[model samples]
Target: MSASKMKILISGAGIAGPCLAYWLARTHLNAAVTVMERSPTPRVTGQSIDIRGPAIEIMKRMNLEEAVRSRNTTEEGTIILNASGKPFAHFEGGDKGGDTFTAEYEILRADLVGLFLDATESLSNVKYLYGDSIKSLDQTEKTVKVTFAGGSSDTFDLVVAADGGISKTRDMILDEHITKNCYNFLGQYIAFFSIPSRPTDPKMWQWYNRPNGLCVMLRPHRNPATVGAYLCITTPARGQQDPAVEAALDEGVEAQKRILHEYLGNLGWETKRVLEGMDSAEDFYMSRAAQVKLPKWTNGRALVLGDAAHATFGVGTTLAIESAYILAGELSKIQSSEDIPRALERFEEVYRPLYTKSEGLPPFFPQFTFPQTSWVLWIRDSLLWFISKTKLYKLLPADEGSGLELPSYGWVDIHRKDE
Candidate 1:
């Protein structure tokens, strides 16, 4: 089969799937690209996310940099506050391409996904399917046959899983042992929701750390009337999972709320208002922080992309965009369906080193940040205050961009001319 006529099926339309679809349609104009999302409709609710490093360049190549910047969350900077709501430390926002706690390209996840979807909407060969997911996948030497949850089956020349870390589609094809051992959970649980903005709320991100490893954060949103709230708790040991937290995760949102309240409800700095907002917040989401490191990203004609392949915490969005671009660029060089596997292998070879280097957290991460006692909290606060006052944060290394050289696949440039 001609590469341009190849049929590709991509699972999970969140970030990576739609992005890959857009680039595939552009690179091979006649290729049939289908993106399937499990949600019944487009999810427009998510916490703010940062786009740093190569992702900013990817946005420019796609002619989406200005559009993305127009939707910035408008977070001025970050402020570490004491229990009394007094600021103890402050960090200013960095430039658009600089790496900082609050990135210059900070925007909500839903907004970025919307931009990707919009970019692909005009391509006749790209299609989107909502409210369904893959039930199973069977891969042959030439193609992958996929069975859907809605009692339907289809065959495609290539199948890519761009689903998130806890990917069910990845489980259908990868070995059980690989699936079990790939996730490195960082003994932390976090919840994000939107609350009505108050007159007292500052434009900067307000972070309060309490005893017993509890932390609360309130950040500004693009919409001035609403603020984003985050609640995080750290367990005693790294990689340890709490039974109650696990049970709550399996249960519904109310159970999750109860667990969060049990841990952070009494902690003073704006806890009451945040919990009250949580009760009525429709977009509350909680998850365990984890990084996925797979031994191999491809098996036969099937492959996993983005978080399903390598899910780092802070740089996940950037990595997803960069990998999608590289995968599409490599596939564009192929002449026939027989070349798909080689293209997939080349992608892993070129990108795996970067992903491996980006897969770790800073030294003494969650434990050091979340103190369990008042003395520790004071010590941490004092250290932060000293750092901020001394302007030592400026000396820290900035995550400018991935050192990898991007390949030019000679694909058509679909960048908007009017921009």
Candidate 2:
């Protein structure tokens, strides 16, 4: 394998795959990157996600800021409503720059996926395979043979698993002793989708949480006539993966919908209307808050990145984009083909500070996010209200990144002026 002609196979084109492709095809790296997308075409289904923290810096490094901003929902912030539907606590706005619950620069997941595709699709070295997936991975000391679902097999010098939590490669190389099974079961599940928008809907993200660990949120989207609906609550261990994790991985989508209806129907604040429109929703997704742990991200010539190797509570996009940039940056500096393994090790070293076993929320988060009792809910709400009013969170150390001040590796910045 020659350094100039390194063959890199990246599975999953959602966010991480395409991002890795972009960096690999950059003038600095120029590695041949092939992206395998399981979806028949580009993914157009997903709720809104924020490009926050260092991920935003990566976006600017890629010069995708304005292009991403153009698709913003322009959400002012979030309004936490009481059972009576009155405002309880409010966060200014969840955007990339804002330190709200989400991000200040929130956009539809589909839009961000499209932006990545638009950036890398035209690159000469980047190729996208739609409706294809890896069936088997056979890695030797030299090359890794990948068998796709379409009955095609290819060998690549280096393989990257960006396919996400259910990744086949992640399972194959996973040291069971290090990372747990695909389902980490975070004691919470969330179902989110888009529904019809109303003329009188608030411009900001509106949320309602019941003391019994039930939550409903309605958020305005780019389409004036559409709203993003979200449901998340604590539940028993069984049937946790049905709704959001993998589209009821073990059951039917209808079953997932039925479960939602059975449990949430009694709740107020347009729950009935949202459930009524559920079937028509295009991007309904449900998932448990599970984290995939791997002692070492690399195994021989293959490695995992993003959610497949490091599934967290949230920040999927941020982690994926940032890791992609860093991975390519590290690989680009490789002195020769053999230096690749050292680069992969360096990549994990950079991410070790960011990786953690306990993913999501924070200390005593369950008592607040999914309060089991009323008194706890009231106390949690009061604390959040006080924090919101006093702006005291700013007094705490900023969570911009891990405590580690990372070394700056020069990154390629792509710029196109359409404005």
Candidate 3:
């Protein structure tokens, strides 16, 4: 097998898949890259996420920084409020130790994904097959045969599962026990939806914490008439036995409305207001927070990267994009298909440690994020106040991309739409 004849199939065109496709083609790796997406089109719904660290460097290298920066949420700052909607502490969204509230680059997940799509739409070597997914994968010593949900089959030299934390392809390669162990659900549930904003709603992130382990947040979007609502609450073990949201999550917006109404209908501080149009909101998403801890990232011809292999807490996008960059760079160096396995190993060895370290949670992280008692709220708010007042937040680095050096991979002219 030669470099020009290599075929790579990637699942999930959300972020990592598209970014991987761009880099793979941009590096002139000579491999045909095809992204199979389960959805018909690019998802236009998701809360904002930061593109910090080395991931930002990749975007700049691709000449996508200005496009991404143009879509910044422009969030002013965060206001942590009490149960009664009274402000307890307000801080500018700047670097404050590891507790940095905002990064230099912040874009809504949908917008960022769109940026990737636009960036790669013109690349002749990259292909996208939407509205379909890999149903089963049967691999041999030389090639892997993939059967799609639409009853199509294809063979590829390598398959990358960027499908996400709950990867179905990972299950096809590994067992149920291994999958369970790899995913450590933080026993918490968060739901996001958009509600019509009030004229008085300020263009800032507003958070309200109650004495019942409930944290509600409102982030003003670029659309002034609508605001993004986020609700976080501690759930039971693993969130597998979710009698509350299991059917709701499967059913539709109406089911979500009924479940959320039963749990958060009576809360204060715009909680009820946000849930008013829940039945009509199409972007309602609720799921358990999880961290992926795979024993190994690759098995035979299949490789799992990004959220599928890492993604602890809520910050996994940047790491995912970075993983794509490294993996593509590694593959670009290979002259023959025989070296793919070793390249995959190098990708895991170089990134597994950094991603693993980032999965560590602070002491009583859930309690600090959403306190259930008055004392906890007081203590948490007081600590935030002290951190802000004393300027101790400056001790921490701004973004994790500090020392990461990006490889050029001889990718000088990779179809970048001019500056």
Candidate 4:
């Protein structure tokens, strides 16, 4: 039960899991952390994400700021385009660091994951298992016994599910009722992929909204040869699940692509080119926008963090980084493995409020943002043009900090030169 001898297993080698491992391995606890990812190799495909508020501080603490900045997507700004592919409104990028649609620290999700993995590579006690997952878990008061999909078994002092919002590992440990009640769907389905870039591609992020609740976004990437593309469709009502979307989610990639094509193929302004790129894209990801609202983050020796615990849209990456740091910090305060439950409780108590503050979307939100009629779209466009012309967006407050006073855990410095 000693701190040095403590063993922790983390599910999902995405942003949160590897980040948690990085901290746990470097903390005073010196816990041996094992990260299990279901994918055969590290996932190198995902939409772009940003780091804001306290997460930027945490990145500095982990000595990853320079490395992260080097991989920036280099998007100059955001441009809202009309159906004719002409810009009607423009918001400059966050180069000077005020609130803007494009953040200063914008990086692809895969690049961030790679950075975290590279950061933890030299840590002797941290291990990564690819093509493996937790088939089942048995938790007692002191430890958790895990059965892996690869037919291996191990006992760990603690188990953390940093998998994702739709975490299979979380389902294994939490009750069905608790799991069911935690989901708050925003009734929006999104598909992300990479499209071959052309000379005409704009350096700024181009957002095109069409009638019938359809939208297409194309953002510049660090690699000019390709661009990140997003296709979105909003349901009629909030919290309503579309049967077709559910079926597409249940089925494989082809079905998901079909659903997107059925909804957005006819819409012009790069729709045809985007769909063509999607057809050849090796990294097409689709998911519904849902928030996971868990009453408690820990159940016995098992705990969930990041999207597995609190998944929201706007500040997901920031929350993931902040939660991992807080969880590791809490564990560092404990003297023995027996104190883990208390530590886990403290982690939620301190972190949950910060998460809830960023949880909900504004009233109508994405629904209202995507107009369904021509008149409504005209109004939206006119309003955006007015706002842009007047520079009204500057009145919005900047994301200064997380408001939660971050605790000093006296973590050991694990700085390494980027390879």
Candidate 5:
């Protein structure tokens, strides 16, 4: 059981990759870890996400709680409004105000990534290669040979793809023919951006639901004069005609604003002001709701972790962080690559049932609803508002707490080993 020697290549540097690198290095001193990121640097802007229950425990294990808390969104709550700017309902903000925003740690996406990058940067055993990605993978009996876009290649004892759910590594290994529909398509498209916080705006979110597949929520930040806007398109599946696209599937800023205005325009409720800020912005994040599902997450010495294997919780950023923690713990339990497939199988076995449900309309929200132009947005907001207020919200498990019995970092829990 002397796991003193292990080498791993983890793909993606966002929440998961760096996390895995940290855990792997911590668990085995002799472990050499390298992470490859497609982006030039860590992402800076992302929606405010709540971390609860087990996930929080994992963060504490990584010793990142204080740093993570410092950058929290600290949302005070939000006011639901009509297209006319008339307020309808309100919801409480982050966990900073008791257990209202879920019984977990909540923070901005960028903040969490920044904390992780900072934690791993000084470790000589852990290396980060930004602006590059795996172009191909060639696996042999004892090693994984990977080719990178930067024309670099390396062989490792194991390869873990903590890359996001729409993982290119998954596509490379599983082959594109396997169209995975595990993602319960919430027919909505989301766009995240930063804009000015006007004096007229309160320290809360102002949600305007005009129907016709359009809903806008403005979340106020900790700083008085800054606010974040999340726009959701509930409508017909819109896309360009040329299907064979190679560019990043991201909707980008200009395009998202164009689509936003096309559907969410001129209804009032600070719409003009919000649109003005968004339109003037240089960048924005736009994405569809899709999850990744794999029949199995391992083939030989390679295993897919986090979103690359099973991405069910929609685009909520905290889920990605949680996935990283769980994967690291599971890997820590395994003795060698010989047990990798079993470890992956066990990991999926433990998590899938807790998340999978066959009730209440697939639990996936579609982007469009015909009567949405009416009061459906009001209803949805009202329900969320109610959940945010009452005990029902508590019933939605706060899985982000920092109390999970994880193995010691840089060392394995030999007692928990699989026989």
Candidate 6:
């Protein structure tokens, strides 16, 4: 495919597709790009996420750093409590890496997608079709023809899947030969929703952990209008993917609330008020905290990015931002159709290790605990509290930017006006 005439079709407009569209256009490609989403409009809301390290640097290149920073979920830090809401542990926020990093520059998922869509709207070669998905793909050496659910078909020089963890495209290409590695299960199911803020919890973020579940709260970033909750319910490994996954997934939003009510719901720290406010939320999200790993990210012209390639539960948004960043960076170096395979290979080679290196760390230390014996749990909790309060963590090297020796690549910037 000639650079001047290359046409590309991308799946999943959520984060990676639109983000890749923005960067591909910035490369001055004499080609055309289109993003097809399964939803009618771009996504409007989702759980909070962060952009850190080289991913943050990529945003700076795209000139979106300021806007992203402006939308951050300024959660000062997390407050851990007992059933009665007494303070047990506190983490002063910074780039201390791991869970605290999830709180860094956190923006609601839908907002991040909107930012990418808005940024690429003006590019002449870029187009987005919502409420549809690719139904079939027929690729020859020269071009690939994509059939959509809406009954339209199009041809392109290449197709990429950034649709996320449960990727249909990845499933098709691998043909069930490659099973996604479920690295470590957090033994938790998380659910969250946006609700009107109450007078009682003003500064944001309160969490409580018990044997079978955990509850967390946060005030929206500079938005006095709402608050958010992150609830995790523990389940046994054999119970992770039940036949009732769909029904259970739908129950996520209320499951946490219902569980909270059953557990700490009576403790009276504004629980009723928060649940009342949540009633008005349009949607509630729920899911198991399981990571997705694959033997490889590519099978011929098909390749996966973001969660589809390496879905890390409890990883928050930073990992997604980094995955998109690395995928796009490697792809930008491709010089021709023949160069594409190498690009995808290098992308996997570059990112998978970085992700592997971060495994086994706590999601929100002092605020969360794995399945430990009662004796071990008490000691670990105490140590976490002492370290958090005494600032002993400052002695350890922050887990920021400790990964790959990445190469520099030009990226596109998209910041809001005030930014």
After superposing candidate 5, which stretches have Cα over 4 Å from the reference? 1-5, 95-104, 175-179, 182-184, 223-225, 236-252, 313-316, 334-342, 349-371, 375-419
- Span of 10 residues, lowest total lDDT, candidate 3: 410-419
Report the lDDT tens digits of candidate 4 across residue range 1-419: 46358999999988888889888866777677889899999999899999988898888878888998899998988899998989989988764425878887899999999999988867778888899888999988888999999999999999999889988887887877777778788888889999899998988989999887799999999998999999998876778778987899899899999888888889999999999999999999998888788877788788888999888887889989999999999888888999998998899888887777787777787777787787888988998899888888877666555453687786776533342
Better model by lDDT, 1 or 6? 1
Give the range of the ten consecutive residues with the poorest summed lDDT in model 6. Answer: 365-374
- Residue pairs of candidate 3 with colliding backbone atoms: 213-372
Query: What TM-score would every model get versus the actual structure?
Result: 0.95, 0.89, 0.92, 0.94, 0.82, 0.84
Model 1 per-residue lDDT tens digits across residues 218-237: 99988899999999988866
Better of 1 and 3 by lDDT: 1
Q: Encode model 6's per-residue lDDT on 141-167: one tens digit a residue.
A: 666788888998888777888887767
Error of 6 at 40 (Å): 1.3
Residue 316, candidate 2: alpha-carbon lDDT: 73
Candidates in order have lDDT scores of: 0.85, 0.75, 0.78, 0.86, 0.64, 0.65
Candidate 2 Cα misplacement greater than 4 A, ranges = 1-4, 27-29, 94-98, 181-183, 236-249, 354-360, 393-419
| Weakest lDDT window of 10 consecutive positions for candidate 2 | 236-245
Task: Compose the digit string of candidate 2's lDDT tens values, residues 1-419.
Answer: 25357788998988888888887766365567789888898879888887766677778767788988889987877777777888877676542224666565688988999999999877777888899888988988767899989999998878898988767778766567655654466667778888998888888888777766788888889889889998876744432433443444358677778778877888898788888878778788876666666678887677888888777666777778877878887787775567777888888887677554224547644436777677877887888789877766545443343333445765554423231
lDDT of 5 at 127: 81
Model 4: colliding residue pairs: none
Better of 3 and 5 by TM-score: 3
- The window of 10 residues in a row where model 1 has the poorest summed lDDT is 410-419
In candidate 5, residue 223 scores what lDDT?
57
